[model samples]
Structures are given as structure tokens and as C-alpha cells.
Target chain A: MSDSSSSFISNQVSDISPVQSSTTQSQRRGSSADQDDVILSIRSLCKSYFDAEILQDINLEINSGDFLVLVGPSGCGKSTLLSCIGGLTDVTSGEIFCRGKNITQLDPAKRDIAMVFQSYALFPNMTVAQNIGFGLEVRKVPAAERKQKIQQVAEILHLQPLLDRTPAQLSGGQRQRVAMGRALVRDPTLFLFDEPLSNLDAKLRLSMRTEIKHLHQRLGGTMVYVTHDQVEAMTLASKIMVLNQGRIQQFGSPEEVYKRPANTFVAEFMGSPAMNLIRAKVIVEAGAVKIQIHREDRAPLVFIEQAATDALRAFNNQSVIIGLRPESISDVAARDPQRSHSAECRIEYIEGIGSDVYATLKLGGSDVISRLHGDSNVSAGDRQQLHFDLSNISYFDPSSQLRI
Target chain B: MHSTIKRPRHLSCLLYASLTLLAFFVLAPVLWLLLMSLSSPTDLTKVPLQWIPSQWDFSRYALLLDWQNGSGKRFLAAMLNSLIIATSASFIALVAGVLAAYAFSRRNASMLLMFAFLATIMMPPITYILPLYSAFSELGILNTKVSLIICYSAMLIPFAIWLMKTNIDVLPEEIEHAAMIEGAGTIYTLRKVVLPIILPAIGATAMLSFLTAWDEFFYALIFSSDLSAKTIPVAIADFSAGRVTDFGVIASVGVLASVPPVLIALFFQRFIVSGLVGGSVKG
Candidate 1:
């Protein structure tokens, strides 16, 4: 309740850290934690429609209560993958297991999975209560119990006032809530959401996004969500599955997928004001590895990166692409001093959004964006010393376009 | 492409004028029929025709409806027969057509077969009349309501299938997909979900098929010989078949026969507009 207790808790944590760390490491090594916690598993899952392959070898293992988000650009098979998991679509080849039971060919009803569709797909004719209870009703749940379950879900979603209204009579956000309530009433083994908030306006989408995140946190339900919005994927997911061209580019925690992307596509697709990738030559000089950025009318911008040195060492005197997030490159005042490097880049353009300014600069023959604080009023053609957070840098092989 | 600009005033006036003229052209025949039904026998033979009858002789309607009168009993029997045949045929067609349409629209059934069905039903009835007549005769259903109902159902089923399919096609498959995934069986989903949404189409189809059967003259004329199964169209023809025909009675019968169809059209006009437009969900 007060600073003393907060300090005491911190002090207590520090005092026990060494002993706890030792025991936890051994426990982790001894126990097969992941194997027992898996709620859903897909092995060599493939889906095709007539002649075209929609998904290919989508293998995934989801932990219980984890919010797994499948994200990509349009038609990237993320939704298809979610549908495959929900048993809404047939898989061409491979096996799907839920809680260690093979349910690859089970009917969607028989498989205890519920889904909220992109269109909300709320029954247009039924009241919100009826729509929420339709699944239970179909399962032949007792009427009074169905009503109670509907009441509980309605209260959770703040849909009690709208329980009597048909979908056509409800707002988009209200309809989305009703769609979710329908799924929530089942309390199924897994929950699926196929771009549930994509239909709402931007403001509503943001609020609903927060609501969904909060819902998952409060309920601790394992959810597999599909969205084309990377921000949604980054913000809501316990683990993010990045898909491109019907193949998973990477699947990891949001930070892991962002900071250490598996490949170029995941790096570029995962961030807004995308990570700047520039082709540069790696050179070793006097037992030190330095990355050189060559320009036409100026000396090469050279900086020594702290991370990725061993990988960079293998490419001495050879080309490799360096990836840096926009926020990683900022005004010189933002330098961390520990691993930050300074670069003199000519600002090509600038866009201001009240809180910050994004200045586009030509760096190493590539257009790179540097996110600057709003007060740093640098204009185009002005050469500025931008600080790069070298600790957050990534190196990719230029030939394969994979993180080195 | 909705325009804010209003049309030219003169053009709108001309359009309204033409609409009114079209309405007059259509309603004038029905108006004439009503006037003739009220005119006396003497009023009909006056060489210079009176637009309005000098006397309103409503006895013709009474006589046609009288149970004791031979002509009235025949007319009443025909009306009953027409009612039974139209209702039965359209009902059977609706039940069978909705199932076929649900299959064609929802189950990825071959649409080519539906088109083929349409093509076969589109052929002139005369092409099959000889075989139909022989079949009915052989089955001992000739001169019966069953014969006409059978023929009318065959004629109207294609129309029912086409209308129902288009309306069902307009429904998003996601709703059914959601239902199926949520544990609703196929039949339950159709009864609870699809049926309610496509009810307008059902109404329109039923009304249209009923009208189609009600208007059938050739089939009824050939199949029904007398009071046992004679329909309104056959009765109207018989009213003018012999010498000394009572034109007032024929006019009255014509006016009454048109009543059910006009009322049905009025009730179903809104549904028809929507059902037809619903098929354009694609683009």
C-alpha cells in the first residue's frame, strides 16, 4: 500500500534472487514444461483449394492460456490457419491435436473450439441473448442454465442492456461483443478470432483491441487470433506468428519477433515506420570489426556495432544488410552512451505528429527513417548527427536476406 | 453514382403523364368489365354503347352466386377447384423447390443441373400434353383436381427453384459457417436461420407460383371436363360457349376471378422487388 512495502518487496526479491534462480534453472531443465502445457498442436498442416495451396506445413504448438496471434498482409493464409484450427475448414494434410487428443477430422461442433468471425456473423434475426445462447441451445443445454450462462457473458461484455436487440439494431461494436459472447458462453478448449475488430471504425477498433487484451488477461483463456494489423499482433499477442506468402516467417514472443526477426520479411512487416535495412560492407581493421557506410560526396559513415559482431566478423570485406528500427535511430541527445553510435545523415524529409517527428534520411544508399523528439526541429537538406542504438541492431546476410 | 442534381421539370412532368396514361390503359379494361357486370341485358344490345349503365342490375352477381341456380353452382365449383389446385400445386412446389434451392445455393451442388432443370421446364406444355393426358387417363386421374395440380406443380417448380436459389445465394455463407462451427446442425440452421431471412423470397415465390397455376387455361381445359374439376378459366369459356349467353354473368365472374390474383400481387409486390435484387450480391 505504501513505498515501504514496495521497497520491502523489492528488497525481498533481491535477497532471494540467487537461490531462486539456481533452483528455477534446474527445475526448468528437469521438467518438460512445454510438453505438458500445450493446448493445441498442428503437425505438417497443409490446406489447398483445388489447384492452389493456401497453407503449407503449418506446424504450431500453443501453450495453455497463451494469446497466439497470427498476423500478415491480406491473403497470407493467417485466417485460413485460424479457420483450420477452429475446424471450420478442412486441412489437406497433417494432424491437429487438442489437449493431446487427435481431432484432425472431428466436426467443428464435436471439437470444443469457438470462433468469432470477421463480419461478427451475429444472427440478424435473433436477440443478443438468443444469439449468445444459440450454441448452448444447439447442444441441448437446459433453458434456465442457458439463460444464466447468457446472462453471465452479457454482463462480462457489458451487453446486458443490448440483450434484447437484434444484430441489425446494434452498433458495430455491440455486434462484435455479441459475437464474442456467443463464443465465450461455450468456454471451449480454444477460442478463435478472425479479425474481429477489422470492421469497426479506427477509434472503436482501438478500444476493442484493448478490451480483447484485457478480456484475455482476466479470463486467462487460450486464444488464437488472426489479424492483418501488426500493431494489434504486437500489442495483444503472448506470441506472434508472422506469415507471408502462406508460410510462417517467424513465431515468437512479440519482442523476440520484433527485435530479432527471423528473416527480412518479418522485420519489415512487423513494425510501423518499418525497420530500415541498408546494404553495407563489413570490414575488420586492426583486430576491430567496423561497419562502413559509403556515400558519394562524403567520407563513409563508420560505426562499430556491439551486438552481431561474431556474425559480422564472418562477413569481413563482404556485404551484409543492417536492420534498425526507426526509434532506434533518434536525435543525438537520445544516445544511451553505452552502445550508441553517431551518424551524420542528410535529412531528406520530415513528418511531424505533435509528439514526435519522423525524419527521412539517406543512409548508406538507402532511405532510412529516424524518429526524433518533437522539439528537434530538423529540416530537409540539413545534415544532422543522429544517434543509433547499436545494441538493438540486427545483421542479415545480403544474399539470403536472413538474420545473420 | 447517386446524383444530387434534380431532373428537368418538363421531363418529370412528361414521365408522370405517361405513367398516368399507362395506368389508365391497364385499369380501363377492368373498369369496363365492372360496368358490364352491372348493366342490364337490354343495355348491352343498344347500338350506341353507353359508357355508364342506365340501371345497376346487381341481380346477375346474385344469380351467379346462387346455390340453387345451375350456372351459380357450376361457377362456385370451378372457383373451389381453382382454389384447391393452385394452393396444392404451389405448396408442393414450394416445399420441393426450397430443398433443391438450399442444395444449389449452400452445398456446392452443380448449378448446371439447375439450369438444365429450368430449360426442361421452359418447353411448351403442348409438347408433353399428349403423354400427360394418356398418363392421367391411364392413372384414372383425368377430370380431377389432382391432374391439374400435378401439371401446375411441374410448370411452377422451375420458377420456385430459380427464385429461392437467388435469394438464398444472397445470404453470406459465413452465417451458416458460424452456425455449423457453433454446433447447429444443417437442418436446424436452415430452419432457424436461413428460413427466417429468406422468408420474403418464399412469400414471393409462393405468390408467383399460385398466380401461375391460377392463370392456367390449356391444362385445365384439357384435364377437367365438368363440375368435378372445372376451373374458373374453363367456366368463363363455358359461359360464352352456347347461344343465349348472359354477358352480365360472364363479366361478374371475370371480375370476381381477378380478385384473388390482384390481392395477391398487392401483398407480394414488395417482396418481389427485394427477392430479385437480392441475387446481385456478387458485384
Candidate 2:
């Protein structure tokens, strides 16, 4: 059983080599030369509300034509930062550069970005055509050209038939489309969206999400989107910036952020049925590292691999945490592998979700979850043996919650 | 089976009884006023307060229109003067209040200054009436329509600004941001977006301003000494204090004085309802 488990650890370590190399290469490429591809650069951004600092030292560079999403829990300053970029709010101190020009004091209209608000922000009194044409009219676009652009954008959004109706006369979904059309008609340099689908029902939000994806693909415009929904961030963003307490916790692609979270917060926040965290103490004996797990009247010491040992060497003889995603653990009785790490657990509950089943079990005085193949005979109050896929385990410093 | 059908029949009987009583309570005074306006003046003093008169007397309303009803009072002139004063004062006050309200709503003014201006609204006109009258006399504006307009408008501006500022405060700031990003400046956004959306509140506030001008007694009594500058209220008050004490004429004048406001309230009743509730709540 230990032979196959060791091979799995070796395989995961081998996979990390290529990922690390590519990341370093990209990092080098960014630092070696000042890439003119940065469409907007925000540096040293700070905001305070009557002495309470909401955002501090926020630095971000948005590349041309990239769809970037800022995601965080509530009150994390994601919306505040977006408003700063749009020039709708005053930053305490910062430099906002657009196309190599400092525009920190520029008004929102002069910043050359259009924002679609969560409430849709459509003029309830105006017809669809007038709302679409309003920006152009304000910019002194010729009436003929305004008509042409309005017609074109209306056709693209399939809003031609509804152009004569006011916003209140339209359904929630239709109002959303009009809001999108209002932003699209301007063809501004940067497009900002603040949870644009949040007001719609579940079905409509899904459809609009797909539509927004299609629009981004078709236009290839630079976008900066904000949402508290991780799924929206995962599916739509080319790059995701996770924020916590007004600071950037992690910034990477969806795959990097999910699999190799910088800390425990990212792991727990990005997944449904959140990751299970168990406390363990680390000890090294005979130049080999092992984690001690204590159960009631029983104790099992599991040896850590060399790679994980190296990562945890700084916390020698200190308590550490083991995080295991629900999918990483399974019922060993269901699948007999060539090798596996087995543990005796007492089944606490079983929840069936059609394609797969989730069972909660007690292991070493803590409750852990395992997702296994369909229809297990396990019920509550039954003793069972569960398998832990050690390859998917994560180690974190127990005090700081930082990934080891 | 028959009693089941008859149950609703019993309910409808009580419903009709209550509704008829309610309608009578509401319509009795209005119907009596209309009938009295058509009766001769001499029959008004007769016993039993005649419900209907034998002859029609349309001459009283004609005399009201002709600007002559003896005792040297000019009703037509007074009505015209009231119209000019109320319309001009209300319109000017509305424009100034809207602009100032926008500033206050945006928090662009100093808090001290805002509170000071708001404090003016709580000061009663009776507190400043003598000083205001003396100032008007010194400025040579006494007994002119402009004097009344300036006085009424000054009195109304503080409350109007307060009302509008509260209304504008409740509107979502995002809509204004959207408009600004659409390339609209302050005036354009106000005229195109903000004004139309809050038109109901605007209509309601305008009615309030007009009503204040129409019903004001102290300012009109102090300022207007001649027949040419007197408003409807002062004219009606003067007519009631005369030697004869014509009850019919007083009733006719009372009905006439209420016509414009009642008609306006009926025409814009929907706006009034929305404005009253909307300004106080979501706006």
C-alpha cells in the first residue's frame, strides 16, 4: 500500500517542476522589459474613510485586451478599487495611469471607461433607443452616426424590437441586456462590470453569463470585472485577484489559484462544501519527518514525504495543519487499489447527490468528509475504513495559516 | 342550498347602506354650495335657509367677473394680481430650490451652512413680518405685485429647498454616475435624467408653493393697501368685514377662491400621491 502512495507523491512533485518553471519564465518576461502592453497601471492606491484605511498600497497592472476579475468577500475593497479606476471615487493617494498618461484627477467621463452597475442603472424614463444614443449625443456624435451605431448595437444585442419601450416596461433580463447595450455602444477603452448578473434569477444569470462571455470573445476588449461569486470569477476571468481585508491574498490564473492556493483562506473560499482542515503536530526522527495524529485511546504517526518535509522544516517540532479537499478522500472498501493509505473511521452521516455520495466520518477526534462512487452500503453509526489520497494533501503553518 | 345563496345577499344589503351614507357625507356641502351660488342674495337671509330658491341670480358671479360689487372693491383686479404673484413666485422658487437642493443633496456645501439655511425654515414669518414690511416700504416695493412675489418666494425658498434636498438625497448615486460617464454635465443630467424621473415630486412641491401663496394672509394684509395689489385672501377677508355681512356673497367668494387649487389638485392627484410618498421614502 505504501509503494503506490509514494509513487503518487513523486508524480505530483514532478508535475510541479514544469508549473514552477513556466511561472518563473513569465515573471522574468514581465520584469526584463517594460512591456507596453499594460493598458492601465494603478500604483500605491490608498483609501481612508474618516481615519479607517479601507485600501492600502494596492498595485495592479491590467494588460491590453485581458479580462481580469477582482474577487473577495464583502467589504474587501474590490468595489472601492474598481470605483477608483473608473474615477467615481477619490483615492486618498495613488497614481492611475491610462495608456501611459496619469489620470488620477480625471473625471469619470474623461477616463475613457464605461461601467455597468449591478442595478442596471438604466434611465427608467427613456426608451431603449434613447438610452443607447444618449452617450453618443453627449459626446457630440453626429445624429446620423449615432443612429447607425445604435441600430448596430441594438441588432447585436437583439434589442431592435424593444427600442421604443422604456426600461420599467422591460423584464429584468431585458433591462440587463439594455444595460449591456448601453455600455457596448460606446466602445470605450475599458469595460467595467459590477456584478451585472446579481439582480437576475438563477436561470437568467446563467444565460447572461454565457452571453457576456460571448461578447468578450467577439469584441476582445479590456475588461475589469468585480464579483463576490467565485464561480463567476473562475469561469470568466483570464486572471483572478483574490482580496481579503483590502489586501491582495493571491493573484494567478484560475487553475493556479484553485490547486495551489497561497493559504488556507483561498482554499476554503474557492470551493463548495469547503476543504476539511485537521490539526497535526510535526516531528523529525532519524532525519525523517512524520506527522502525529491523536485519536481517543489510539495514536497513528504518518511519515511525510521529503518534498512536504522540506516545505515544513521551518516549523520543526511545532503544530501544523493538514487540509484535504473532500474529493481527495474516498471509501477504501469501495475501491481496492494496488496501494493505499487506509484509516479506520466511524461513519457519521451519508448524503447522496445522485452521481456521487458524500460520507462524513470521525478520524483522530475530528470529522472529515469523503466523496466516493455511488450507493455505498455505509450508514450512520457504522465503522468503516476510508482511504486518504496523500498526494492531494496540503500542509499549512497552524499559527499563521500560511501554506507550508 | 337556498340559504347558502342568500348569505351574500344579506352582506350586499349592509354594503349598500354604508356606501350610501358615506357618499351623502362627502357630497352634501359641495351640492349645497352650488345651489346657493345660483340663488338671489335676498333669499339668503330668509328663514329655514332655503334649500332651493325660486329665481336664479347669476349676477353675483357676473359682478365677480366685472371687477365691481359696490364698496369700491375690484374682484377681477384682485384675482389677476393673485395669479401673477403666485405663478411668478412659485416658478422662481422652484428653479432656485432645485439647483440649491442638488448642491445640498450632493454634500457639496459646508455642513454649517446647510444647517444655517435649514434653520431659516423653522423661523415663522410673523417673527420677521414687521422688519420685512419696513424694508419693503424703504425699498419702494410696497403695494406692488413684485413686492408680494419677492416676499412669498423668499418665504417659500427655504422649505422648498429642504423638501427637494430630501427627495434628491434618496435617489441612488449610481444613476448620476452613469449619466456622468455618458458625458453629461450638471445641467444636462438634471434636465434630462433627474428632472423627468422626479417629475411627480416636482409637481407636488409646486402645488405646495402655490397653496402657500394663495392662503397667505399676514403678508398680503401688511403689504397690500390698495385695491390694485390686493390678493384673493385679503379681498375675501375685507368683504366679510363690511357693514351688510352678505352670507351669500361670502359663500360665493369662498367657492370661487377654492376653484383654482381644487382643479389643480384634481388634475394632478396622481402626482400628488406619488410625490408625497416618494419624497418621504425612496424618491
Candidate 3:
């Protein structure tokens, strides 16, 4: 399975234009030479609590100015991994290299990192300015310099008016901004965030998400962020690492992870409403690979062409899982024109979410959702012709749950 | 709607009346003690108990405060001893207990370990008083303020730990982690972050520990035989031991002895209430 994925990755790499590939190769060489561009590198990191293993043999390389987001469900070791990098939690095994230095066993303070926590974690006793300047104070930075840097960070975060107010006096959003300001004032090599926006209301979360993205763009500093919210992960991250049960399921660009998830878990976990996993069997017909999807009442023999069919040729006549995102399957008129497989199914439920309409229907004996434009008139109990864009579909081995 | 509003109003009136009656019963003894402290010796000894004495005199209080006399000197020394011992014991207990509770709360110590630490508080203090007395005597520190301070601190440490632990447990652990990431060490984090947030709990614990040491009778009685190391409770007991038992003098001493703790409670009542409620609810 690993061999096949490696080949697949190499093939994808080869498909990139030659000039772009050469530049990436040169950048890789430059990174290897000085190791200046790679801000943090974790090698075979593992953490365990007595008998329970919380993080397993994890490896990651984060580049300078990269917004890397580690996203997973609760207890999936995303936060633990972040803590390990921040030196708040000790790794059971493995090396953590920051700026080419082995810092796995160093003190968190000595690691030259700043972290913002979900609870804001502002010092209730200190005013906003004092909270932001605490790191500078601990570093024995002179009072005059600390004041200037704090003022600058406060101005950037629009926290000048809250300088005299303690954390309890500020609203939740203000506290969160102060937390970010505290981290920003340090000017550390890396910033670690553990669900920093999770405590805010939905509107505030969205705005903060945008603000953090803007901050990343402005500062161009390395960051390792952990969140369970996929939308935040997708919108803010230059790279996304999907984790499950203390193991990294996939690590890639957000588009790569979304379009070609490495496993069934990543496919289901990364998308809201989740990708529909339809049980199907592959069949080689007329020297071309096709899939046989058996429905509940009528078995519609829909043959879809996907680029991965060649790799899945050996699994012909065997049951496999087909992953289709909600947006990939839509009304016929809303589907992409390149390659679409159309089928008629009775819509069981309709959910209008202002901009889009989600219709749940039975496909291949399993419930699959189709996302259509809001103006696309469709209702429950209606026989709708659903067009599934097969170009971006994923195939996985039924037993192993690994993408084929 | 009218009936519902009226019903609550009537219920509140009944509740207030019952609360007032309970307060009167609870305060009656203290009020009597105050009245006794104010009455003249002749008026206090009168039959039917002069609830409101015709003549009030403060001569007993004056005598207690006259440091030139032997009795007044002993009373002043005892009061000073109580102050020193209570303050020292509570200060030591506060320092030791806050550190222990922080470790217990953050380190994820086993349940058995926590229960074992707490087991000391659950056991009766009298059970180990004999051993403690022997140890202090062998150390040649018995009947000294040092012995009483150590004993009182030992007794209060476990209770202080329990209270501080519950308060610290409710504080989000991420705050401490954030401090660490901000280049602050464990001591700095505790002082700047954890200490300030849990200051109320510390205040309440200190007050309670001081009161416990101030009012302790058994340890003070067994440990100190002289006014040099005796506390207020022991002094009050001594006041009742004289031949003919001057009730007026005893009441005066008792009233003075009760003042410090009452003042402390009144001064820090807000912190005490919130700290106790925070502890119990989190537990």
C-alpha cells in the first residue's frame, strides 16, 4: 500500500510543469543545506501516558512562514503533538528540531515558542499591556523596549483601548486578541495555537479566523495550529495534517487533502456533512475499468471513469468503497461539464442552507448527499437526476480503509 | 401570574421570619457574653441574670490591659504568643499547602496518592497527639512556641491542601501551559498566573488556619505550661481556673479573644464565601 501511494505521489509530482518542479527541487536542496527555511521538524515523535499511547511515531516538517494546521477530533493527539513541539509535553521517543537544533527535551521557555490557548489564558491579574509584555519581562528585556513592542502589538491587534483592562474586564473576543497579542509581542520563531478560537461565538470565530489569516500573511512567521474545526483548517492553513487515534492519516495541502484524502477517515473527517462512502464493486468491461453500484431496489450500472481506475484494476470484482463529496454530486444542471455520471434517485430530505441546498438520497444502498445551488428547485420525494462529478472521486480498499 | 407573584412574596416573608428567628437563637449566647462582659461584677452575679445591667462597667477590661500588673502582663504575653504562633503557622501552612496542591492538581497524581495525602486531615488529631508530644519533648522543644507552631502547621497543612487543590483544579490548565510557552518557568507561572487566580482560596485558607491555631485548646494546653507560649484559648481556660472564678474577668478575656477571628472573617467574608463555594462545587 505504501509503495502504491509513493508512486502515486511521484506521478502527481511528475505531472507538475517542469519549471515549477525544478524550482521546488532547488528549494528542497536549499532547505537541506542550511535548514534555515524549515523552522520546525519532528522525527518519529511518540507520546504515551502509562498504558495509553496518545501520539505515535509522528513525523512532520514545518517551513518558515507556513501556516500548518493539525486538525482532528478530540483525543486524536493533535493538541498533544502541538504541546510536544512547544515542550509543554515530553515525547516518549523522537527528536524535535527547531532551527536545526534538537529541542525535544528543552524547557518550553527555552524553546523560543509562543502559544495561544483556547481559553485565552490571559492573566486575570494583569492588564492587557502587562499581559502582552510579560514574556519580554521574563526575558529581562528593558522596560522601555518592552513598552514599545507592547504598544506596537496592541496597535496591530486594536487592543490599545484595552491596555489597562484585566482579562476579566474584557469581553471574550478582546481576551482572545490579547492572547494573540501576547504571542505576537514575543516575536518568537514559532507560534503554537491550541484551538484559540474555539471559545468564541460563531460570528466572532469567523472574524477571528480571518484576522488570524491576515496576521499570518502580515507577519510571515512559522505557526503550528491545532483545531477540530475543518473550516478553519481549510481556510487558514498552508498545510493541513489530518490525525486520527494518535496517528497522522494524511498531511498535504488543503486542496490535496480535500480532493485526494489518503484514507477513508480523512475523507469523512475533513468535510462538513462528510463525503458519502458508497459500497461498490469494480468490474473490467471491454478492457476499461468500471464500478458496479448496487442500489436498494434497482441496481443502476453506472460506469464512471476515474484516473485511479488503473491503480485499482487488480481489485476488479471485489467490493470497494467509493468516496463522493456532497458538492461533487449535484443536480444535472449544476454539475461540471468535463465528466459527469448521471443517475435518477428519489430525494429523501432537503436542507436549504441559505446559499446551497443539500438533498439526501439513496445511492448504492447507502444514503448519499448532493449539494446543489440554492436556486436549484428540488424537494423531498422528488425523483431528481443527480450528476456526480467522477473526476475527483476516491477509491478505498473496503477492509483496510486505505485509499487505493 | 398575579397569584404566582403573590405566592413567592408570601413565601419570602415566611423565609425571612424563620431566618431572623434562627439568627437570634444562634446569636443569643454571644450576645449574653457581650452583656456579661459589659456588666459590673455585682450586676453579673445577680439572680435572674441581668439581661440589661442597670450599671455597666469596663474595669475588668481595664485590668486586663494594665500591663504593669502580673495578671495583665500574663494576658498580654498570651495574646502576643497567640498572634505570633497563629500567623507563623498559617504562613508556613499556606506556602507548603499551595505548592503541594499545585503539584497534585497538575501532575495527575494517582487517586490513591491524593486520598492518602487527604487521609491525614480525616484522622482525629488526638490520635497522634501523644506521639507528637513525645517527639517534641525528645527534640527539647516542648512548651515552646516552636512546638505549637509546628503542630498547628502540621494540622492545617492537609486541610489547606484540599481547599487549594479544589480551587486550582477548576482553573484551566492551559493558562499554565501558555505561561510556559511565553518563556516563564514553573515558579514564575505559579507566582504570576496560578497564585493571583487562586488568591481568594489562599486568603480563605490562611484565615481558617489562623483561627484553628488561635482557638486550639488541647495542643496549647498539653504543649505549653507557661504564658510564654500559651495561646488565647489556653489563657481563657486559665482565667476560669482561679479560685472563686471571676466570671466577669473570664467574659472579658473571652470577648477580647474572639475579636481577631471575627474581624478577620468580616474583612475577608467575600473571599471566604466564594473560595468555599468554588472548592465544593468543583469537587
Local error of candidate 2 at residue A134 (angstroms) = 2.4
Error of 2 at B247 (Å): 3.4
Specify the poorest-scoring 10-residue window by lDDT in model 3 chain B. Answer: B274-283
lDDT of 2 by residue, A77-195 (tens): 99998999888899999899988789899988788888888888888778899988889989999999999999999998999999998886788898889888989999987889998
Model 2 TM: 0.87
Better of 1 and 2 by TM-score: 1
Clash list (residue pairs), candidate 2:
none
Clashing pairs in 3: none
Which digits, one per residue and each the tens of the lDDT, describe model 1 over residues A20-117?
33442443343333423778989878899999989876777776777889999999999988888878788999999999999999888788899999
The CA lDDT of each predicted structure is: 0.85, 0.78, 0.84
Superposed model 3: Cα runs more than 4 Å off: A1-36, A295-299, A304-309, A332-338, A341-349, A379-387, B1-17, B108-139, B270-283
Better of 2 and 3 by DockQ: 3
> Could you tell which candidate, 1 or 2, scores higher by lDDT?
1
What is the DockQ for all candidates, taken in turn? 0.39, 0.39, 0.44
The fnat scores of all predictions, in order, read: 0.59, 0.53, 0.67
Please, what are the lDDT tens digits per residue for candidate 1 over residues B157-243? Answer: 888999999988878888888898899888999999888778778988899899989989998999999899999999999999979
Per-residue CA lDDT of model 2 for B1-283, tens digit only, reads: 3555555767889999999999999989887887777788767767877778888887667667663456324666777788889889999889988888898888487767667877876887788889888999999989999889998898888878888888888788888888888878888899988888777878877989998998888889999998768998998888788888876676677688889888777777876776555432111
RMSD (CA, angstroms), candidate 3: 4.3
